[model samples]
Target: MDGVDKERVQKIVYEMSKGSKYFENEKRKEATINQKIEDLRAQCVLLTDEQISFYQTVADKRIIDLEASRDLSKTWLHSDMDAFYAAVETLENPSLKGKPLAVGSMSMLCTANYEARKFGVRAAMPGFIARKLCPDLIVVPPNFQKYTYYSELTRKVFSNYDADFIATSLDEAYVNITDICNDKSVSSEQIASELRNTIYEQTGLTCSVGVAPNRLLAKVCSDINKPNGQFILPNDYKAIMTFISSLPIRKVGGIGKVTEHLLRDVLGINTCEQMLQKSAYLCALFSEHSTDFFLSIGLGLGGTDTPQHKLRKSMSCERTFSATEDESALFQKLADIAEALSNDMHEEGLCGRTLTLKLKTSSFEVRTRATSLQTYIHSKEDILAHASKLLKAELPLSLRLMGLRMSQFYDVKPGRHDPMQKTLKNFIIKDASQSTSCSSYSSDQHLRNGANIDPSAAEESCLSKFESGHLMAVCEPEDYQQSNQIAPVKVCRPGNDASGIKDNADECVPQVHADNEGRSNPEESLTNQNGKMLWWIDDYICSVCGAELPQCFIEERQEHSDYHLAEMLQKEESLNNRRGLLQRERPVVSLVGKISPVGDVARKKQKTSKGKFIPIDAFFNRYKKD
Candidate 1:
């Protein structure tokens, strides 16, 4: 798109894809976007002078609040590999250099080389369609293993700059070089140049680097001078504002084609500056979440901190969203994460002496602080007490994510390998984990079905045939939190609105009537249930997992309990497998050596002789001597 004839390529793409399903789907999506834009436009017309004034006031107030939280101390660099997959392919096959090349099959293309891109045969285009755009284009199958090898090579270079750099993908990463710049007394430009040169030297793959005060602008800057180039936006308010004033809205990361159409067609917002000029319209037409991001973009603001943690043999829970410096909100989120972590630890009968608190700044600088206590703790109250102290020490810090990791197990003695090894193998907690490193990381769940909300979305019916079961703590019958009042349970039916299977809901628990045409949104059902939903849940929590499950659903709770037990058993079995392998060689080295199964080993080793049963090893040694 940068240099190619856009109209010609559009015609070629259309000719090649006109009748295809992909084309039709794209058309459908375009129509939907257009319809949504029209709806927004209509709403805009309906807004009176007073309404516009009110929205503008709200927007201005939010802008002031958001600006107060900005941190310009960190210099964020977004390093992007130039045509990563294609470049890797070319590096491996020198003959492919200077030729139009693509890394993918006829079905889809991951990326295209610079030469291919000039012909408008770009990434995400179908390979067959790309061929039409540029008949000379050479398509190749992707080799991820080779790509990963080179990616690691580049990340090794990255570790030198910032060991905690966040690798968003194999070819791109956001690194906060604030400390290095201060320590080395160097400019941000020099660091970006060094990184680019070092990566080129090591892997024969050139990269583009963008240096700015925050991640968003850095990312935009990286794309400006593409193909083995670098761009640095000055870390000054005037410079940042000037740079983004006329920048295209489409250049922003989260603004896709649909959003591009919406803004340009509806609000006449073609640039970041225009977005600010029309903030009132944005606030009026879109959700607060969407408007907040738009306002931030207009002001040249973005997340400077997001926590990237390295979870070891520990239990942790965290969430990521828009960054904020709110004290009460931070404490509340911290408490929630801690509570979830507590439940996970208790499920596995674990307690730790050390608690690590993780905080990522809006600029993505991770600050981890820790506290060690003499006594091990697993309860939510104790975890929160220690973690809150650690968080308080880092007060007035703007954070996008917070996590609590409980480590340094109480049962793990320093010198004891067996217990530690067993614990490592057996107690691999499946709790939510989050981490950040200088290199790329892999993989980043809960099932609460049967939500009680939205009467229109649900169909209610009575389960007259249903027979009630004694269901207090049905998840694990022995694990009940004893109380005089029996709390109700919730039964969840998958692929439907969580059809409440609550037994004795003061009546028959409502069954969501099966609607053949009704669409189900599982994600919507899983969102934070509001205050209204908690009216009947009372003070009760699920006995088995210690999570709040509200009023009961017995059959589903049993399923959850079964799943929990099965997971525990699987971990125990894995530990046994490891110990079994270790024990196999132990008896050969010394008969007196410890065996894993004492009773079974005794049965196998003991044998009756003439009078008394002699030790097996001693008896065998005497025969060999004879």
Candidate 2:
């Protein structure tokens, strides 16, 4: 024992003996003295401080020891079971012992035991790759609900000793066990050992206990030992420095691969010691925030105060795409992502207003765009469509990665009068109608899905409809420009149904217009023998209203087809020059809910008398009924 601790023990004993209680109640007084002596003797035996200077190594050491021993005096404790998931799986199926095991879902591995580390298997690695690495590796699916049940049971057991301790996650917690052991006489290590035994007796899993000056050191020390092991670290500078120097720079939390490479490979730094030495340069390289953290870490200075913060405002998950380019493939991938994200949001009972699309180019350049609507979004298609609009506005760049993040969280009160429900309901209804329409579309008509609508034909359709003064352009010039530029498969609601009748329809029926891109196609041009441009706008749109629309509207295009730019232009030019094809009488053709050839129905009907023929009035009556 150090002289100072020895002297303190002597003083306590001497004072207890001098008390009049010794004479009045000799038994009680002697008991008190004996207890004090034992307490001091135990601590002294453990090697009390040899140095007493403030901020000195010995001072820190003694204080840390005091905290540890004091915590031990309490009845409660906290410990984390190492590799709990993999270990439990291996233990229950004894035949799998000593083999690598991981727990996760279809896409990514969640946890892997030490055995898996040998083969470079790790958490977050693709499950297929993990299996490839260790052909016989046991892959266990995560049973989070079951794990949570057991975790609650464990917490209840710990509560019997002290109510203060809490399990932070499924894996860990902190306990304040002050009231149970009451004596304040025994060392904390002895208490820790007893707690360990009690835990093992109740649970098959083993844990490592770290008794230290505070949570920081305690947590760090706990990891020093493996399963079923326990360790402690004195708060002394020398001991802490020795411990830190042995760890890799990356071992310090927040030092990721990029930062590791920046420090180790780029800056020629390999160890914590080297990082500590180049503090100024490192700070300049990273920024003020990172430099301060690393410096504190190097100095063995950790948080002593409790954490205080509000609940998380949002939850998000994202991934980097494995392939770049191929816009169709990118769009499909994004659609899948939208579906997955919407599903997750549904699971969490949340609907967001803001939809953010993040894209990382092949050069690692990141671009993000977000749009906040007045309504909430829940369906995958709606989310993907909005994100697609934004993507189209962005210049086409080879994509290294893309992520869809939904935020602007508004609470979802399932039973309340949610204002966001109106839009979401409309989206659902529209999606359902689109499904039905797509199913009934003729094979030839289906081919037009994702087909580029010709600008001139769209303009002709719009101009002709407006000339009749019944069609109203609901889309602004900007939206028309965007839809036309990207050759989007569908446009938003046209303020009326396909029959041009305005009604309070909740569903937004998309308008399929002529592909404007066909006019710009290399094979099709309005120019004569000379290269002089004949058309101011290669694609036609309503010159007055500018609603670049098709002569006949049809929506629901199949995925994977690039814009049929060539065919759409020929169709547009034919419609614009319809005046050249003389006709005796104009047939009032109601091109709604029926498939008809491009001005070939009359010829076909004449060629075959058996062909079914119907008066134009019948078609108009059918349209009115619909």
Candidate 3:
């Protein structure tokens, strides 16, 4: 049944897939891949022997460079749960064990057990197509909560071997166990054996473990033993290289179905050894990066370090629904997505400056629109505002899926030596009355230094604002519910400045104002209470640009400042046009007394033209030259 039943499975799959939307889409992709292969073959045929030889020289050099960079001192392990989701499902209900089971709906299969795989039923195939292959295939709807619980248990086991194990997904991880093997004076095989046994003992789940000098070979080795087994490749270079030589290129991580077909069909590179032999043709056919990647695979080299501390690039939430053409319903869905994204951001203590709207049309076409803001935002109101704007811009969109993502994070929490706190302490001490204790003053204390401190009065005012929907809670309720946790929100009286309070000290306290019609105007309320034109200098503010910020957790302020500087240059260009001076012809003047191509003349104008326009880059670039 190794290869004999494959054709029967294929015929059944083709019959089940024929005329279906998924099949049609797959056919279109296959056609595109076939055309690419044909093009590559044509390109190879057109190349002269001299040109082929030149590419071969370049590829050989690349291979030498890659092989030189390989490190055999490290022990890398790849551990993956055996049919993870299916295993978890069967574990929960032992009756489903040894049965051909698949997890996910009829629309798609998430994962299938080895029992199902015997019938050629696989992950990512539509459940109906899988059913056609194996009529007895049991389809179970995915339970992410249950899966997450078991995944955490497995990760707990992984943490014992390597604290910084890189979890690629819920079921798989790449762990660097170099220190463990060295410190414990044990072989990689022994370590992997203990890991597998511990996981099975703890969670009643079996996992495959592969140990090699690098992640690439380790991952390939893991798959060799299939379910509930372990494989180890020695650190010897000859053994590692020999193992890779016979292995199919398709078995490598980065080589997908399309790349596999192209290599096999066009270059006739079925194995890693064939890839090295055909490297010259691949180098000529593919980009430099692609060529390097193929050669690295042939040399059996891959990333050994697990980047555990890498900050998440973005946080997002999305859901799929039945296709809908109703504009109002779409807007409602957008709002829901915004709310979910806000909750996720709050839970993670993250706020993002960029809001991205992702929409999948009923026809399966995906459209994404992203907008960057002057400030970091994590509130539902703020997210909804930007998301709605993007959504409306692409009006009358019929969609099946909607998503909201936030990126460019900033931490809003205050540091130990927060500048805002220092400023507040200075102001409080300067204005303190004789009876006031400036150093020990609690947030609940009323200001005796010309300011009224009425806790009851302030609480009433805050409650009124909350009831009117003008005041929004800054922190999640669960945060305060934890024992020994400090409350993140504080109430302050309206028309009374509470700049000294920890919660409001560095935050942009929106001043709600009543208009002539008694309606609250949020736009006018953005200004300071004294009616002065000033920037929102909250914790998320851009220090250089004076622009209000969204999230400030991550180190993106420098990048955002550069963005502001770029905008200032564009403004300067526009100003130069209005003044009838060509931008390039006009000599750049220094705002500060710094290095200047035109000498001291640029610095002299700084005093006289104090209110005039001064671009940030022009000022900084002069100093940079100096």
Candidate 4:
């Protein structure tokens, strides 16, 4: 049992955890796993010789592919702080150094120091159970702020060696030292030693470092020499293959407890060598991704390169509380969580379309409900609206934990131009020009005289309208400004009659309008009542609403028109339903089809009620007369 006193530890753990909710949950999980193992064995028994041969052929091909992709030139170093959180707490209070210590509360243990681990107490095990095993265990509440400070100190040393190091966690990092090894005329082992020394000198903390040809081997080697030690695997292929062959599959990252059981119990594959021997069975049992991973491990191949830049895939905020069934209290908690999530998104300049609500019932069951929006949302109001809907759907739920997660992130980077922006700009410009040509001089005069516009005011107004209309697909604000100048101009279509403006010739600037009007005044508009030039082009108007939109680009004007059209459709649908008339279902339909059975019924009902139902106004008049 890897030097652990398994029987004694198990007895203590069982005695402490018996009859507890957590223990019961573990029992249920164990039973589920046993059932799955039995099912896997049955499937194996039913497999034929032909199927096994086919699977072997597939595994052989996959191994060949993985071998072809292997790179052994670069040197990678994986560094992990020894009992990070526990060490930090000890450093702050030196009196607790030799004593057994664990970080976290009685419910859960985050990390345990070497002294505590001697009694088989480890991270993630409940503190109460740990106490039963090691009676002298000193449970210290975690101090994240202290840990972060020391983590930063260690990272500073890492930056000196590899500027683009990957910090996998608060206390662990993967650094590529290939360039440094070459530059300093030293080996990877020497570099790792110096790094460890530097970290100890700076933070007064002990750490373990491992140097290998790739990150996977480096990480594995880092744990071989426990706390305050360094290990180096030679860059030779033979050395790596020898080391990986005897290594347990469980020791490899990504192969968790369930996978370990599958390899050992089902396939009788415990070590990497066994994995290679039973590769055929694995290919048949697992998916392509898992098969590839197992073969890569067996071949001692791992990622040799770390990504230069990392983009966040998802962001979440979660909290645990006493189990409660109060609906009002739960909603209040959710509202606070939504607000926190919104603040984080806004601070990071992130907007996501998908929102997920995660809850852990008092019985330790986890449930998640996700909903996606057509547009990205960042505000607290939008987050709360979606979260409330999801929460209400699962109402009367007694929860011990609640969390909000947002994913499918939008690229909210400012000043980044989209490829579709130019095409959308051209479409809007063409439509706006067409709409302006149809307008008469009376309307143009009305805009010039009555509409009060200022350059900055118009710009702000257009921006607000663009955002409200969800025109992100068209163009960003920076792109819009760059494509179109924020200046007022009158668009005159070619070949239009200029009779109305002919008398005021001197006041107008002669300009040629494309397509419909050849001769017209490009500038004959009056200033606002405040004497500020209204920064509006006479050509930019919403065709649907016939409302003048003071936008600098065509895309903005078109988006404004689309927003109005959507509003009008919703209003029309409501009005038709009130009047007992079936709404036209052409423009608005479910994803499946435009004409559904429900729509057919509504239409039939409308036809039958046409002559029987009185008009809304007539019905009201009849009631008044009575």
Candidate 5:
């Protein structure tokens, strides 16, 4: 019996023998005590506290003993689908069976079915490489929405057995059945079998479970016979050590290529037990953390204070090459890494300003360097530029491992409906598009979908889950047609004439009164009235129906300069509306844009720059009409 079960048995006895029941009738009480003892003995193998604790002792000892002799056992269960995505695809499309298959994108593979594994196709492998291995392999894109639904169902199945059942990831979990089966009655083998059977019945998917004294052994044991099988770690330490020591160093936590080489080549330590033996040496070789790591493994101390479910602070993607060192090859690999990292960011609606580069040398010198940009960048070019710069600055060194980490996240703000800020953001967008603007432009312009633009493929998957927004594939040319076709109304620029008769231009720029009276210029006010009137004319509504317009008008613009002024206003309104919508629609990605009130100091700056700062009156006054 385990520690959990032993406590339960003692508690049951104390509760039953404590008081009045035994004293009420000595003859009856003696029989009841004997029966209770027999019952406890019967459940000793699989006993847990959750089992019924009989407060009222029974009178029949022989019957209780007979019940105890008829042994009842409990089995631990773990069920996971084999190559969950590819398998699901195979199940639906029968033609996919017998043929190698994988689930991922054109860039990389997420997971491969067993058939694909035989041909050296594996998870995270580049699709091109996988295709070379198995030319006929069918590649299916990931259906994350369906995967999430299935994950929730799997969690529900685990909870049905034990609310305390711990899920490690999407497809893995551990259950402590010691409390469920009581101390003496149930066997671990029995518990394992029933749980597997229950999961199959509920989910129609088979899984493998491992029964052990603790979770550490259970995880390792479970992987031994996968795809509907179970294994148990017995009551022995030396045998367990031998089993663990024979495995690769990668099996041990924190034992990457660098650490593994340090242990095997430098320290002459290879298996778990060998590494465990040299814990002190490892501590000195690496740091305090490395020492604690090996020591914990040595003692089979797996569970830590770390909670099972916590938000991932950082996400990284990396790859190891078949060859030792090539800078050009590393560049291509870096591009792939950047694409994957950015795609994940877009999916999670996250933006990270910090980029980290990880490298491993042939001599196994692990080096890492990171730099944080002024703004979050999600483009492949930007990611590669930064990562490559770090590598170049730190290189002329051999390489074995390379990784990219996107972290130091900033939340994406929702769309706003502010007119002035919206107009300003558009001007910035125009500035950014004219040049190779970094991610800051995308961040400032509120053009988040710019990061999702895939130049290679015309058919891109656009998913806009928000009610007000859309997942528009830029390739869908028709979606932008109507807005793009509507040319901007002509607004004449105030050009200078050689004659110096600039009455029309000068009249528009109304001179302030010499007395500095409160009387504002009527002609200046005429432009203001025209703007207010024109704002009502072309502001973001159907001129005919007056219904609120869709966002497409602001996004799609004609190249003609005639409509520049009105077009700018329309775009500004659209940006503001989009910004407002983004903020309220999805607060998770909200990057809060504060509005600072313009004071006399700001006016002076605007005046000197000739409205470069875009003061309200100059913008509306100068560009309101033709």
Candidate 6:
């Protein structure tokens, strides 16, 4: 990395990617971001001096409250293995050391060594592009099992320092060592140095360490000094402020490119210090979650305590391939992913009631369809049956990627060893029998009570608090009569019968249902010619108000959507906020870049690469099981 020509690397990457589909996709995203900036500017102009003053008061009050919440009593350390995957490869084949190297397929790269970094090679970049950057680069297929084994070795070392340390990924972790420091009568710097030495001795891999008063700062600090180094930030408020004042916003976790561009280009906020200078605008424009984060950056505040483990919410599998419109090929790919995901789920002892189908078109646009089922399912047959339905609705198709995610875990684990007893129709329709087989999760009863399966059904939720999407609707709940909210309130299994599970499956039919997003479908009238229903309208109408509005009435539609969202929130309030809270927990389903996977249920996460990484987004938001 020290020898890397950053300018040259960017030039080559740009030249190589310029005419590609991935590049075009990035341009589309850039245009969207530009429009958002323009809209923000427009809103800024609309704000009066009084409004600015009012927002300033609001920002100040929030800042005071945020400041009071800062904790400096503990010391935290973030450890990041240097070029983890690549390092492991080099360690395995010592001869590969000192050569330009990368880990991943020709389609995409997972990571590259420091030597390769000199040639602009890095994680998530396509291997083909990396080849153009450095033909001398040695690309190695990723061996995740090997990586996991080494990760365990490093984690064992981590346990010696902080038993509750959080392993974010195979490569990095956050360890709170306040008690260790206090009991040992040693400083945090000492602890970090010792931890690094111990990890190297245990795993035979070099790592860098960052010691700070909180997890946020520690994570940022860990990256300040690259491969095999350590950076420490003291507990003093002035020292913390001084350290953060000039920090680039992107360098902080959660501040990805879009957030970086929005803060920098529109608000003219390039550093943490400038974030506060524009706090009033931030408070006025962004949600409280986002604004609080921005102000906290200005104040250098971060969580100092160990994060409690959370229940695993989701698991997924995806793949990238050469562009194809062949529906059979697509189904084949879906089948493979289902099998892999089923294996991953079973191996991890997880069964989820919700299944989400993710697809990326050849144009690089991503679309998702999700549904919550009545029973917990992990068998291949169940996953495929549900996923095939979601996929079929999206055809006639051309795609580059596809994925399936399961979430909203059930309390009582259903047996996942059963073969399909009922067809796809059974799952879509109601099951009135005493209960579904614990294994198949569907029965003859389900088939008998079937309703016509609507390929497109009520989407999960529009629960995003993030203000990024251009035409995003409010949490679009279907009208009462058509409402299909199926929160996993209970798990029903066979009363006394057991079932056998198979590792295979099949089903899907193509009937387009209304989507929560207002995105016009190619098959439907985009402008509602002669009052033809818009393809994206929920059940041929607004989900919230049940109005059969024409597509031309965008403003009226948006207002109705907003009112519906407000009304739903009010109803949630009356229900003691439980529905809203649960809905919020489910990530807003959208047609965008890949939905960040919610994490693995077991210790060794199914770390399959989509055969590539798109660093355009930092996804795979992981949650460890308690």
Per-candidate TM-score against the hidden true structure: 0.53, 0.45, 0.65, 0.68, 0.42, 0.66
Query: What does the lDDT read for residue 329 in candidate 4?
Result: 91
lDDT of 6 by residue, 1-626 (tens): 57778898899889988988889999999999999999998898999999999999999999999999988898999999999999999998999989999999898899999999888788999999899899999999999999999999999889888877898999899998999999999999999999999989988899999999999999999998888999999999999999989999898988998999888887999889888899999989999999999999999988876654354568999998888999999999999999999887755545577899999999999999998775556778889989999998999989999999998542211122123222112221222122222111122222224432122221111112112221221121133116553211111111211211111121101112336674423222111111122233553464322457556444344333332322222232223223343234433221111111111111111222221211110111111000
Best by TM-score: 4
Model 5 accuracy (lDDT, Cα): 0.49
Cα-based lDDT for every prediction: 0.64, 0.49, 0.66, 0.66, 0.49, 0.65
Clashing pairs in 6: 417-500, 417-501, 418-500, 418-501
Compare candidates 3 and 5 on lDDT and give the better one: 3
lDDT of 4 by residue, 374-432 (tens): 54566688888899999999988889989999986533222333332221222222222
Clashes of each: 21, 18, 12, 7, 46, 4
Which lDDT value does model 6 have at 96?
100
Tens-digit lDDT string for candidate 5 (1-626) = 11234444345434544553323344454565556545434544343433223211221232243324321132333345557777667756788878889999655899898777766677877776677667888899988777666666777777866676777666777776766656546766777777777767765566778765545556667877876788876535555556676766666545676556546655567777665555434443445555555654554445412234333457799886653567787778878998898776544434466899998665445678999775445556678889989988975766767899987553111243233222222322222232212122122233334342232121112212111221111111232335553211112111111121112222222212211344321111111101321121233332222334333332211111112233233333333334454234422211121111112112222212211112322432222221
Candidate 3's C-alpha runs over 4 A off are: 1-4, 393-397, 411-626
What are the candidates' C-alpha RMSDs? 26.0, 26.3, 16.3, 14.9, 24.9, 20.4
Give Cα distance to truth, residue 59, candidate 2, Å.
Answer: 24
**Lowest-lDDT window of 10 residues in candidate 5?**
521-530
Best-to-worst order by TM-score is 4, 6, 3, 1, 2, 5
Q: Residue 445, candidate 6: how far off, in angstroms? A: 38
lDDT of 3 by residue, 1-626 (tens): 24337988889988876886556667777888889888989999999999999999999899889888989999999999999999999999999988999999897999999899999989999898899888999999999999999999999988988877888999999888999999999999999999999999999999999999999899999998878898999999999878988999889999988888989999889998787898999899999999999989888888876653455679999988998989989989988999989877655545567899998877666789999875556779889989999999997877899999999663212222322221112222222221111211231234324344343343343233333332222221244446544333321211121233322222432334444456533321221112221222344453333555554223243234323322333243334345554433433221111111111222222323212233332322222232
